[model samples]
Target chain A: MTGNIFYFLTFLTLIAAVGVVVSKNPVYSVLFMILTFFALTGHYILLNAQFVAAVNFIVYMGAIMVLFLFVIMFLNMREDTEQHKPMLSKIAAAIAGGMLFVIIIAALKDVDTNVYHPAVFDSQIGLVENLGIVLFRDYLLPFELASILLLAAMAGAVMLGKREPGERNRF
Target chain B: MELSVLLIKALIIVAVFGVTLLIATYSTYAERKVAAFIQDRVGPNRAGPMGLLQPLADAVKLFFKEEFVPANANKFLFIAGPSLAMLTACMSSAVIPFGNTLYINGEYIPVQAIEVNIGILYIFGVVALGVYGIMIGGWASNNKFSLLGAIRAASQNISYELAMGMSIIALLVLSGSLSLRVMAEQQGQDLFGISGMNWNIFYQPLGFLIFLVCAFAETNRVPFDLPECETELVGGYHTEYSSMGMGLYLFAEYVNIFVASAVMATLYFGGYNFPFMYDLGLPHNVVTILGTVVLFVKILLFIFFFMWVRWTLPRFRYDQLMNLGWKILIPLSILNVVLTAGAILLKDEFFK
Candidate 1:
């Protein structure tokens, strides 16, 4: 049953992700992307990563997507008058994406799948307690470093958005 | 049969999501009424008794309202924007532990919809992605005001999320666990037989404060509501959205507020735990029910507090918001982590 659910969710996610890439309208693309996230959340739940699934919905779907929608709405973008991408660029993007996907699949193929030991999936491991232990005890420094990266992103955003003195009509 | 177990789980998940949706809906009504009350006026009493059915009325009105698609707007994205908002807003409650486990016929049923290691990180990761919804919506609207609002919202969320994550780090260090259930269990037990001092909030008050402030900003509540300061941006990112699209954005904000409150209650306020809760010695089912009720009550109080603050404080200026988040909160959070570490080391060396 779990396997079936996982397969279904994966199918939904991949299809919507493709839709996001292929859709002509940016708004439709964003919506499809959100759908993709929803499907991904389902997948996470199937994997027993309930916290990740919930956060995926909250952070990505709730916070990030809201920002995206807001930006798309605010920009009031007109239909693209620009011509479609050159054949070379399109082919290049496709090739790169295909190569990356192939590489990922190839990398996974070598892993020993038959060694799976199905323990009574302890709910405690996935609870906030275990996550806290791992984060603080093992990944504390890297976690702090992520904060630094966030700080830098904030600085960059402010610098980009700020109106410098005597820079009128800058758009 | 396994099928029966799966069905039960699915039903529970759907029920939780449904209840959250209902709460989100009513929150909108409550917000307006509270806003009116704070401003000293009769709130929406016409929809039903005390305007209890105002949300339903509003939903109907929104449905019947004429939908306007801007001439230059990206129609697909414009429509997708609000749907994304509503969908994502409802997604975060899956991992929350609503109550303790209930034993039925030798089977133990966990209160949470799903349990996962790295639950807190998952919350952070998903929340990080929420900016895209606004960015896409705002940009698709093809309106300058909307674009500006979207950008503002994105920047605001990204900024505060850092401090928020930092605040969580301090708690993580002290709790020595990441799973909400484990954390709650730890908090439930008194430290070294000291009564009423087991909660993380007592040990890490500064971290709790920082997290609370960041939570406020994360939810885009006032005074951090720079993205939708009506006087300037003219409804901000949703300027071009009408009817349900607009409603979705507004409703999502309340839901996000609800999620944040739930997280706060779980992390710092001893989720579902009350003073001397064990003393009651209630039946297992009753205890679990009481725990769930306690959690909801805490969440409601937090929601009320959110409304109260919105009425009490003025919105922060854009630059000021940035300064507070980056210069003030970030540094303070860092210092808090250092202090927590020192305290931990001292305890290990001297007390141990």
Candidate 2:
């Protein structure tokens, strides 16, 4: 049953990933991205990473995707209004994506499958206790660095987002 | 699990689903009746026995109304909006521990749906996903008013969720567990060495206050409901939604309220732990049933409080809503976490 569910989720995730690129409307693309995230969450659950699954659902589908949808809607975009890219640029973009995909596959091919094999995936690894210990004890410096980076990004956002007196009242 | 065990689990799931629907249904009537009573008028008295059947009538009316699809709206997304809203509204109920264990045929059955060790995180995650309902619904309506409502809802929910998470951090410090079941058990101790309920509300009143305020914002209730303000936004996010589509949005709010009330009660009020419950000298099954009733009473009280504040308080302006969430509640909740951590450390150093 679990294996069947995992395969089904994987199929759905792949389908949604294609849909994200294939859909014409930006809103539809966002919705497809959300579907893909849900499918990924299902895979996380199958691996007994319930905490990761839930957080992934909450952060991506709940918070970030909602903001994405907000921007798409606020712009009131239409398919007719889209500017077509040059054929050469489109071909180049596809090539770039393909190269990145091949690079990822080649890099990961040499890695041991046992790293993520279900049989080797300890159920306790996803528990908040164990995850917290590993994060704080073993990976404290990297975790703190990530936090510092996020703080800097947040400051940058506020600086850009704040309205200047001369730029106010345009509406 | 045996066939009978699976069957029992299935039955409980159905019961919980039905009860949640029933509660949501009656709450609409209760909100009106409460509003009328507050405003010095008879509310929904023409239906059946002081409008006891008003919600059923309302539901029938909603179903019969014309299902509208805006000419410019995204068809699939317009349909999906309400379905997602209602789905997430009811999803969090699975993690709530309704009562103690029931002894049936010499086997123990816990009065809860699936028990994930990260029960609290599960609830938070589901609650977070609920934002998509309003966001999608408003955006799909193809109306500027609806778009504004969606923006307000997204921003409000995101801001308030921070405070809510921080407030719960205090509870985690106090209980040292992420499971709601464990937190409830920790709060079930005797009050001051006597046979009384030891509720967490007494210890984490500041956190509770922050949680309560954030819950209102998260659910888009009064005093923070800028998204659906009638005067400014004209039904807010559901302006273009009609028929059962609109009905689903409204119904989801009631369900969210019921679930939020249940959460607040379980976290602070000792859940199903009644004061001196062991003193009753009842059978195990009977005690569990009584415990469930106690939890229900607490939930109902919280629901009433929600409605009371809704009718009594005025809505905040958009800026005010953001300011309250980002400035006041978040900072206060963070301070609460700091204080709770200090208290825990002091206890460990001195008492423990």
Candidate 3:
């Protein structure tokens, strides 16, 4: 039963990911991307990682995707209003994407697939209590440092967004 | 046994779904009645027996009305908007424990749909998704006012969610669990020599206040209801929506209110836990049933409070709404967390 669900979710994820790129309207693309996140969240739940699944659902599908939709709506993007891309950039983009795909396939070819077999599953690792202990006890320094990095980024954003004393024009 | 357990779970799920819809339906009638009471007028009295059947009447009217879609609107998304809102609104109730375990044929069954450990987080995720319905509806309308309403909703929901989560973190620290069931059960214990009187509200009043305010904003209730403030944005996101599309959006708001009320009761009001509960020496099943009734009473009172505030308060300007959410509520909730942590530490050190 679980295996069937996993396969179904994987199919959905892949289809939605492709849709995100192939959709003509920017709003449709954003909606497709949210579907992709939802499928990923389903995968996480199938793995018994409810904490990760809920966070992924909230942060990616809820907050980030809503903002993406917000911006896309504000732009009033339509297929007819879309700008024609230069042929040179299109070929360059295709080449870049193909290269990344090739690199991913090469990297995964060396991995031992047996580790991911259902027989070796460790459900406890994905639990919130266990994750909390690992972060605060074993990986405390790295976790704190990561938070500090986020804090610095927030400060940078505030600094950039703040208006000057004599500014009259609003962006 | 396993089959029976599955059947019981299915039964609970259906029951909860029915009850949520029923309460939400009545809440619409109650809201109008309360509004009329506050305004010194009779409300919906022409319906069956003092408007007892008003929601049914309203639903019939909505169903018979013409289905509408604007010429320029994105038809698929326009249809999906209110459906998504209703879907997310209904989904959050799965995690709320309505009562203590029910005993049937020597099996103990929890009175909730799903007993997941990350129940609170699941509710948060669903609540977060609730904004999508409004945003999609507004954007799909292809009107400038509708787009503005959608934008306002997105920002308002995002801003309030931060403080809501922060306030919840304070409660999580005290309870030491992410599950609403666990939190509710923890609050059932004795406090200050009164059995089943140990509510979180006694300890986390400030956190509760912040959460209450944020809930108002998150649900887009007045005075934080800038998104659909008809004075400014016509019908807001559902401007182009008609018939059941508009009905679903309105119905979804009541469902959201009901769920929020339940969450508040479960978290801080000692859900399904009544004072002197054990002193009566009642049978276990009887106590559980009574507790369930108490929980629903608490939920109804909260719903009434939501309407009460709606009629009493004036709508905030968009800038003032942002200021209250980002500047006042966020800082206050953060301070609540810090204070809760400090109090916990001090009690551990001195009292122990």
Question: Best-fitting candidate, measured by DockQ?
Answer: 3
A22-114, model 3: which lDDT tens digit per residue? 888888889989999999999998878888999999999889999889888888777887899999999999999999999999999999966
Which regions in candidate 2 have their CA more than 4 angstroms from the true location? Answer: A114-121, A163-171
i-RMSD values for every candidate model: 5.0, 1.3, 0.6
True contacts kept of 3: 0.88
Task: Flag regions of model 3 displaced more than 4 Å.
Answer: A116-121, A169-171
lDDT of each structure?
A: 0.81, 0.89, 0.93
Best-fitting candidate, scored by lDDT: 3
Q: Which stretches of candidate 1 lie over 4 Å from their true place?
A: A1-171, B1-11, B191-197
Q: Candidate 3: DockQ?
A: 0.91
Per-residue accuracy of model 3 over B9-59 as CA lDDT, tens digit each = 899999999999999999999999999999999999888999899999999
lDDT of 1 by residue, B105-193 (tens): 66777778877556677667656665666776887687878878878888898889889989898998888766888787677776666
What proportion of the real contacts between chains A and B does each prediction keep? 0.42, 0.85, 0.88
In angstroms, give how far residue B129 of model 2 lies from its true place.
1.4
